[model samples]
Target: MSALTIYKREVSSYFAQPTAYAIIVIFLLIVMSLTFTFGGFIPAGDASLASQFFAWHPWVFMFLAPAVGMKLWTDEQRNGTLELLGTFPLSTRSAIIGKFLAAATVWFAALLLTFPIVITVNYLGDPDNGTIISGYLGSFLVCCTFLAITMLVSACTRDQVVCLIVSVAVCFVMVVGGFDPVTTVLSRSVSEGLAEAATAAFVWDHFSTLTRGLFRLQDLIWFGSIIVVCLLGTSAILSAKRS
Candidate 1:
């Protein structure tokens, strides 16, 4: 079987169940609610999504992305289907990438649904289109990053709840580690070089950079490196289990 075959199967299975729909609804509710209420979308008087809209993406993805990905490998393992899947003609890497892409497609659809917000901003004010697009790109990358982390965690366990909890915890650290308040507190005690290194390794700086409409090569490298490392780790764990 090709990766495309596995991708189509996983995507079909996701939409066949209510899991994908529920997550998309919850994500929309939380993000839109926060955007208007706490995020001060209107009150901020900011034309760009950087401050009031995209700012909340990392926090939202820190939980929901893992929730969406928790079942990727955990369900197969729990239902004793992992071994059966391994017997397929496809490589373990193909299965991993297919499932990951399927999860990403669900989130991509959810993000696309938020286009009305784009229309609203455009109608209300002349926001920079390039910046808005960059913010959306950054938000999607944030979700993918969490999903990749969850894939690795899900491969290590059979229980979906355990996968969810561990994945969220790992994502939380990455988000919090780059937060200004947390960094400020730590920077006071730690050396500046160490604090800078920690921030660079985490998600906030790179994500914020993109949200600001600045697509740096290093930002792409950071997100890509973490994602590639996690997916490879998932492959290794599954391979060991299959053997």
Candidate 2:
């Protein structure tokens, strides 16, 4: 419906310039380089592409996905078009969904651009293709999660730079909140259960669960819920702005 219309327009705008394409290329190059250097694909002696490829996705998307989504609404407001967009027949939620999908599609295209990594893994060893596929799925979900968070931040500001900084800060917190240092501090000051709960609430925990090819319904639910919540938050913010 109207969401589709906005989705089409958003997607078109991304490709109208070389920005999306350049981002995809740079993303692939950086991640792939990190895989070989930091991930130790060959030195680790792992048959699966786990550490080599998928391990860096969460960190990569932390910045890249925000870059993709930061301008979704900020640009509209900056150019004095958000009000015009609001007057359209489309619902606010629909517009939010459309913009989210558009940003998600750009990330999907980025994932596809790295097909050669899959091919390389195949050539190097008889890897578990099923696990590899699941990793891709998990990475996509994480990318969309970043986009949704970015959209929420973007909706609150017309300054794209502010949107980008705030998005990155939020994302960095979500990433580190699950790491040992944060959890360790939480455990010392708080109950162990509270520490565990805090760690579980972070995006990295859910993302790691899915990336390991553990398709738990709960992990999927966690990611899906984050996406929905962020989209609703964006819509609510935009509605207030419109009024």
Candidate 3:
């Protein structure tokens, strides 16, 4: 089978269930609630959503993205389909990429549904459209990063609940490792240098730059590196298991 065939199957499987719709609705509710309430979008009188709407994406995706991806491999293993998948006329890498793209597509649809917020921001004030686009791109990347991390974890186990817990824990670290509160606490308990290193490793450090419309090359590289590494790791683990 071609990668396209696998991709189509995965995509069909996602929309066939209520899982995709539920995730999309939950994501919208969480993001919208945070933007209006805790984010103070109205009181701040900001036209841009970078600080409010988009800023919450990493935290939200840390949990939700894993939920969406936890089944990618875990389900296959749980249902004894991994061996069936192995018999297909496709490379493990093709299956991996196909499945990853399918999960990414689900998040893409979810992100698109958030356009009402964009409309609201435009109605309230004149916002920089370029910055807003950057924010969306950043949000999507963060979600993809979490999804990739979850994919890696899912490959290691058949239990979906175990996969979800470990994935969320890893994503949580990525989201908060560089957070001001986290870094401040780390600095006191360890060498300032170690704390700085932790901050550098944080997904936040890379993701926040894009939300601000500062497309630094290094930030892009960092995100790309993480996603690629996790996917490659997943492929390696699956290959070993199949052999």
Candidate 4:
């Protein structure tokens, strides 16, 4: 009936299933391994873990966030509970916000678990804590954006698998929109302004700004705008179902 109640229920549901546990474990393993092995945080002469850690977040969230968010509305629709939920005193906007916050909480917990890496970096060398802090902020914002997109996609379908696939595709494009491969291909046939615009559309652009320990207002606004728009779209879809 209240936002807190909805938040608690959604968070509880995530932990109740094995999927959430599996995702968290896999996420940590992949991120840690990549950071040390490939990112060369251990052997590349840089004592700071920020490079290895933040570098993997965008890729990790591309898949893991969708895994967490795919069931938000799809499962309710599949099990015929969405209709009941719409009848509650809670507005659609509140329900969407509550669910988004719940999913974001899970992501925050996942990010917090990586603090040992942060501690390890501090133990090894005089790493910039400011950069590490900014990295966490960037990572969380990226996850929120991904989750919002997945939530909107989940609302569009009763099949969670379909939702997951569609969300992944959409998130992937957003992640690579700034990559050289993507931008290069676009540049060959498009105007420079158009190519730049394409590259600017990805989360990677805004995330890079934060990862540099520079808290740019525009980057925060961009990520926040995406979250708001996607969640608002999700609420609209659910409201249509209710009507």
Best by TM-score: 1
For 1-243, candidate 2 gives per-residue lDDT tens digits of 999999999999999988799889889889989998999887877767766788798888888888999999999999998878878787888888888899899999999888987897788778888888988998999889889999999999999999999999898888888877788998999879988997789877777766677788988998899999998898889888767
Going through the candidates in order, what is the number of backbone clashes in each? 0, 0, 0, 0
lDDT of 4 by residue, 1-243 (tens): 588889999999888978778888899999999998889887776654557779788998999999999999998899998878777787888888889999999998888888788888888888888887898899999999999999999999999899999999999988888777778888897877877897678888789778878898989999999999999899888878767
- Kindly provide the TM-score of model 4 when superposed on the true structure, using C-alpha atoms: 0.95
Q: Per-residue alpha-carbon lDDT of model 1 for 145-216, expressed as tens digits?
A: 999999999999999999999999999999999888877877899778777887898999999999999999
lDDT of 3 by residue, 1-243 (tens): 577888899999999999999999999999999999999989999887888888899999999999999999999999999888899778888899999999999999999999998998898899999999998888898889999999999999999999999999999999888887888888998879978888789988777788888898887888889999999999999999867
**RMSD to true structure for each model, in Å:** 1.0, 1.4, 1.2, 1.5
TM-score, structure 1 vs. true: 0.98
Provide TM-scores for the models.
0.98, 0.95, 0.97, 0.95
**Which structure is stronger by lDDT: 1 or 4?**
1
Model 4 residue 54 CA deviation in Å: 0.6
- What is the Cα-based TM-score of model 2? 0.95
Off by over 4 Å in 3: none
Candidate 2 residue 128 Cα shift, in angstroms, is 1.1
